[model samples]
Target: MKLLLTSGGVTNPTIRAALTDLLGKPIEECHALCVPTAQWGHPMCGPASVRGLLAAEPSFRHLTGLGWASLGALELTALPSIGRERWEPWVRGADVLLVDGGDATYLGHWLRKSGLADLFPSLPDTVWVGVSAGSMVMTPRIGDLFVEWAGAPDDRTLGVVEFSIFPHLDAFPTNTLEAAERWAADIGGPAYAIDEQTAIRVVDGHAEVVSEGRWFQLTR
Candidate 1:
């Protein structure tokens, strides 16, 4: 599977160009399945990020927005109002899954509870894309950032790729990088600390730095 793991939204024009180039076409040409809570505003029932990319890209034909599962603490609780049948088809037929940034702990919980963790692996052609919180979930464990009650009872993930991903390294004011380094030191596995505007492209289980940012693979 091809994974286009980004740090956050493609808000920067250069980053957006990089994303388009990596995908081998304009954003409009591909299907954008956004997982929105990857941002801070919508912690509970927010829309996915894929749609935002599509909306920003000039080439994309369809922009599919999947709302979050209600288990989160955010305010957008409209999924139940819209019903499941309306959302299932888009999710099932999606060619790409773009997980937006948000609270990783909460994102992980809702992913499992909503059966997305199980359903994602079954999608044969879907490419997994992540940014921020979306990127963190790709790891085996999550960093301590949320309220104590927000964490998942267990670490269950999509296992799309190996390696713990730490985003927003530059955003953290107090020793965020040091904290990530500590986590990597404790995990004793390949861990990446990516800055905003940076991304890692993993193809067939191999990862390479695709953007202009620092990517460190920690080793003891």
Candidate 2:
């Protein structure tokens, strides 16, 4: 599996360049599926989450013309309200899935409820690209942010990746390198603390740092 995990969003020129270089073409060459969390509501409703992905690509002019190429926005909110036959084709047609940052609990809840959690992994040819909260869901455990927001004692996650990924480390209070070390010690495997502009690309079972910031591989 080809993974393009970014720290924040694709709007940053450096981030976009790295992504384009990794994908071997301009940002417009790949089919982008923008999953925004603002539709879910406040706190998670930050525009920066998906602004980068949408701005970097030019193919997403309208919802109907998305299938042509470049980019598309898979409005998760529309899925539950619309008929499956009408929107399912777009979901299946995407070549790259880009998830925006948001509340991990809400993001996971909506993704599973929309029947996309299972569908995404099952797609044989699609590349998964996640930013911030989008990347957090791929792990086996959610971070303290989930606890602060949802207030469930334990973490709820999708378990797509063996370890948990901590994004926006420089901005979040609970995501320090020391905190990541503690989390790794308690959770087993490794915990990745990714700073702004940093990314960890996991292809198959291996992971390597691919951006300009710090990447801490913490373990017990």
TM-score of each: 0.68, 0.75
lDDT tens per residue, model 2, 66-130: 23256667867668888678877887776677776666666777777777776765675566677
Candidate 1, residue 31: the lDDT equals: 60
Q: For candidate 2, what is the TM-score? A: 0.75
lDDT of each: 0.57, 0.64
Candidate 1: Cα lDDT at 83: 51
Weakest lDDT window of 10 consecutive positions for candidate 1: 67-76
lDDT score at residue 193, model 1, on the 0-100 scale: 80
Q: Please give the range of 10 consecutive residues that has the lowest summed lDDT in model 2.
A: 59-68
All predictions: root-mean-square deviation over Cα? 6.7, 5.0
TM-score of candidate 1 against the unseen true structure: 0.68
